[model samples]
Target: MSTIADVARLASVAKATASRALSGKGYVSEETRERVVSAARTIGYVVSPNAASLVTGRTKSVGVIIPYISRWFFAEVLESIEQALLEQGYDMTLYNLPSASPERDRVFEYFLARKRFDGVISVGVELSDDEVDHLHRLRRPLVGIGGAIRGVHTIAIDDVATARLATEHLLSLGHRDILHIGGNQDEQMDFAVHSKRLSGFLAAMHAADLPTNDAFYACELTVPGGYEMGRSVLGDPRRRPTAIFAASDEIAIGLIVAARELGILVPSELSVIGIDGHPYAEMFRLTTLEQHPRRQGRLAVMSLLANLDIPTPEDASESTVLATNLVMRSSTSAPRAPLHHA
Candidate 1:
């Protein structure tokens, strides 16, 4: 490997002059700088990134802590953020924090302490007050996605409003007895997302004076999870709700599947609405609210990068809820005249 000494000898300049020219920190004449650069290129010389970071105090990398990777929305967001970082010549180091546990402490006390990252972006997993303070002490910028932090820059859709919108869509179709197949909020140990979504469903039900009780079945936030819950809920056709609101598109797809198996045709006998424009939504011909998770990811990165240079705003620790659209599909329809009973 060619060294700085070799470049200096080839450029006919002292090592200190070559260092000044290459580092770009101190002044070097234009002609001298050009010669040093040319000599570097000729010798196929490359500066040590670690050494550069030591001098410049920048790692040019961002650390990301995400909760889940198997989910469609989160995975899409991760991919978008990765691409955006790559485009900007920044590296991303991912830390998968599946459900809050002692492992998260290791990430905070050990991994993040390395100071290898210029900033941090959290996806879906909300950080605790202590965690935020710890990062603040380290002077590392932090951005969040999925929901707002009390004092952190974040990007996400209003879960409450989005859920209410889904419910209202069914109500617009004249669905009175609506069931919400939602996540098991009680089991949500890491984040408050499930409760927020459930609250939105209840808020809409209260606004319309509808039954949002146990008929509001709890389901896993996946297609298979939704299918299992849907089968049991829809089995008793005599008690099944006229319409269903799934917390996510995955659940909605599962509900639709269960409806098919039970000989209950969608829209004709039962209507279903879901959040997220999951890829399968198109294949299953389901109605959904298209919340661009990838766009949110990119936006979070932008916000985080901005904070790396300037101190984040007082409201920077807050959240910016992105907008969504009601992407109407054939999955929703008016309740049957006689109310089809299995």
Candidate 2:
């Protein structure tokens, strides 16, 4: 097969010069680098990653740990991360496992302890102090998505503020009787996202001087879950809320489906709002807060790659909080009649 020696011979450059040109470690003239690249392509010569790692101490790969692959937000983040890594000529190793599980313990204790990657990007997986310390000891740069982690670089949105904004939007529309449909607080995802969102909703309600008793309903954080809850909650005319703030776009879409099934006109009979800029949101014309999970994923990769240059424990401790924007749509409006207690 073709080798760097062959490429160097074809380019009429010394083997050491060709090696420097291909590795990009030591400086080579721009023209010489291009000539070596052309010669390698002509000879179908490829650099051995193992050999390169032996020389540079870099695997040219990144390890990604995430909790869910089927969920929309996590899926989007994973896709973005993979794409960004590919563009940067880096390989990605994905660990799709549940949080707080025995398998997770093994991966962290055994698999990651080996340090086969140059860096790590954790999406929605809250690493413990010990785990963070382990990676630091290995001198592997770590970056997290979904929430802040002590002593780890992280990129996340302010869940509390985002949820509060969603609730406040409904309240501004004169919705005194508003119900929040979201993930179960008792069964929270990593970083207690469900609880934080619920807290935000309550904070907004209390600020508006509205009674919050029985105002929040727990669900599975999916469309089917929202449909089931909507059927029961909207079935009773006396107890029906004038507006609903869904924790996700899927739930909002499900609630709208249930409302239609019950012969209730949207925005006129009841208003609905949700988080997430899910692709279906535009189809349903749902009002929502666009959190942009893909953006977070891309940012996490960028942050990790930037730190890979320095690879210092101090540089790995930075935190970045992203912003969510409100998207106005046809799903929400002021109540058709004067607001009254349900």
Candidate 3:
């Protein structure tokens, strides 16, 4: 096995220069790099990873920490991140953090301490001060998606604003008796996205002087969650909110199903709106606020590459905020007078 030392001796270059030249990771003069490459090729020198890490201090891998992989948005984000990382010639190691505090702590204390990746992308995993500091002290660059970090790069839609937009759109169509089918109030995800979205709903309702309190129905962020909640909330014809602003398209789809099963009609009887451009959203013809999680994942990778290209400053972090727009569809309209108060 030809070692770097053998390449250095054959090329008559210093070991350090030979390492840099062979790896193409750091700065090396063109002539020197070519000579080193030639010598490496001649000797069939394959750089040892352990040996290379001892010199360049990089694992050439990325750590992606996420909360929910089974959910639509999270899955889409992961796929986009995977594709982007592959194109950049990098490897991604995923860390699926279960919603448990002790397990979450173990990820930071034990798993992160292993130091296998060059950097990290916390996909919807909010980092605590200690966790952030631990990674920072490890000299790892981090970028957060789906939430905001106190002192690191982040990219996400304004969850509150987007929710408000959805609500107001329903209100604009004169649907005042609106319900919000959303995530649990005890969501342990990094960003309190569920809470933020609910906030938007409340803010919009308050702004329009519409009824909002107790109108919120909490559920997990899944079709089943929505379906279960819809059955409970919409089961009673006397008290169902005329329109609903579901947290995600999955929830909206479930709402539609629940409504139909209960012999209630859509648009003519109840209006529905949701966030996330879920694939089933189109199939269900749901009106939604289209924030593409997959595209957001791609953009997050782009941002990471951008920061990786330049020299990352120790004390400074680069942040980028993406944009979201409302996508109107046939899921919503003014409630009929029978379902609305005049």
Residue 82 accuracy (lDDT) in model 2? 95
- Candidate 2 matches the true fold with a TM-score of 0.96
- Give the true-structure RMSD of model 2: 2.3
Worst 10 residues of 1 by lDDT: 310-319
Q: Tens-digit lDDT track for model 3 on 115-149?
A: 67777888887777778888888767788887767
C-alpha RMSD between model 3 and the true structure: 4.2
Best-fitting candidate, scored by TM-score: 2
State the local distance difference test value for candidate 2: 0.91
Q: Which pairs clash inside model 1?
A: 151-317, 152-317, 153-317
Model 2, which residues run further than 4 Å from truth? 314-316, 338-342
Better of 2 and 3 by TM-score: 2
Report residue 304 deviation for candidate 1 (angstroms): 1.4
Q: Clash number for model 3? A: 1
Model 3 misplaced stretches (Cα beyond 4 Å)? 1-22, 25-56, 99-102, 309-319, 337-342
Question: Which number leads on lDDT?
Answer: 2
Cα deviation of 184, candidate 3, in Å: 2.4
